[model samples]
Target: MPYQWPTLTNWLEQIAQPFYQQGYVILEQAIPADLCWALYQDVQHQQLTAAGVGRQGQHQLNQQVRRDHTAWLNQNNPVQQQYLQQMAQLQQDMNRRCFLGLIDFEAHYARYQQGDFYQKHLDAFVGRSNRVLSTVCYLNTLEQGGELLIYNEQDQLISRVQPNAGTLVIFESCRFPHEVLPATTTRYSIAGWFRQNSSIQGRIDPPQ
Candidate 1:
């Protein structure tokens, strides 16, 4: 069967409620198990390139900061399209319930090799990008390590998330400072962001 998630309204009642109460929300089995494995297989066959930090011209490879290969999601691909469709519905529900005014969604397949890790950082800074919410959908289970740690605005550790397959993690882009711990083994996931159309200070939302 094709990928399908819970109804938008029902899903929000359950998923978004916790999201607002806490700084983040985790949805187990958000994506079908078969779909998760398929996505993992897709990444295995994809020609992933070194992921860079920042956007466009400022984007540069900083392996020391983040060591992962990535491939941007595109609608041309069936699997990616299906995954995106699910998120599109999520964006609509988010807007209706939370009034986020989300305009678009972008995602990419991220694969972290053994010993890879991403330093603590914020996904979006205020008045910088349109990234309102950040999300990660784990495609494969991490054997050991490769945990995600999110910190509060005060820089205090808030929650630790294990890389469990078919789990979706959602959090505010600017509010939470998160990092991926060292990957004792390879890890596969889809990382994405929900964007708004409006920009601040006459600047583009994001140059990506």
Candidate 2:
């Protein structure tokens, strides 16, 4: 017998209530172990570049703020496609259950080497961005370090998440301020955002 992966329905059912009540949710073993393993393998061969802060023209490297390498996820790779498909299903579910009006999702593979960290930051600002929900899926486990710290509106810590394989974290992009703590060992994860189309005057507000 082969290992059975959880269905999209299962994930949808698990996500709704907690997310509605708290604006965020963390799920352990959210993805299939085999799929995570495959993605991790794919990441090893990717040409990762130093991640930047801010968007488009404002984007620039700032090692003081973050020190991770990243590569955007695309459909051409079968492994990445599988993960994207899962996220697509999640986007539909979020729209139906929460009326989020999500139009699409974008993601990237992030690699955090030892001592790498990302300072606290919000994924989006109200009325300034189209990103509605942010998601993080861990592809590799870490015994220590690389914990994700999520803060509430009062700037108080609410959750400390360990970077465990197959764990998924989803939160309202503009409501939470979060950061990645330095890792004692290498860490791997996928960070993604669900967006609502905010086109104006026949132009994409934020070009993909």
In the order shown, the candidates' Cα RMSDs to the true structure are 3.0, 2.3
How many angstroms is residue 38 displaced in model 1 relative to the true structure, after the best TM-score fit? 1.5
Error of 2 at 68 (Å): 0.4
For model 1, residues 73-134, the per-residue Cα lDDT tens digits are 99999888889998998898889878888888999999989888999999998877788899
Candidate 2 lDDT tens digits, 45-144: 9999999998898999999999999999999999999999999989998999999989889999999999999999999989888889999999888999
Candidate 1 residue 3 C-alpha distance from true site, Å:
13
| lDDT accuracy of residue 2 in candidate 2 | 26
Candidate 1 runs further than 4 Å off: 1-10, 200-204
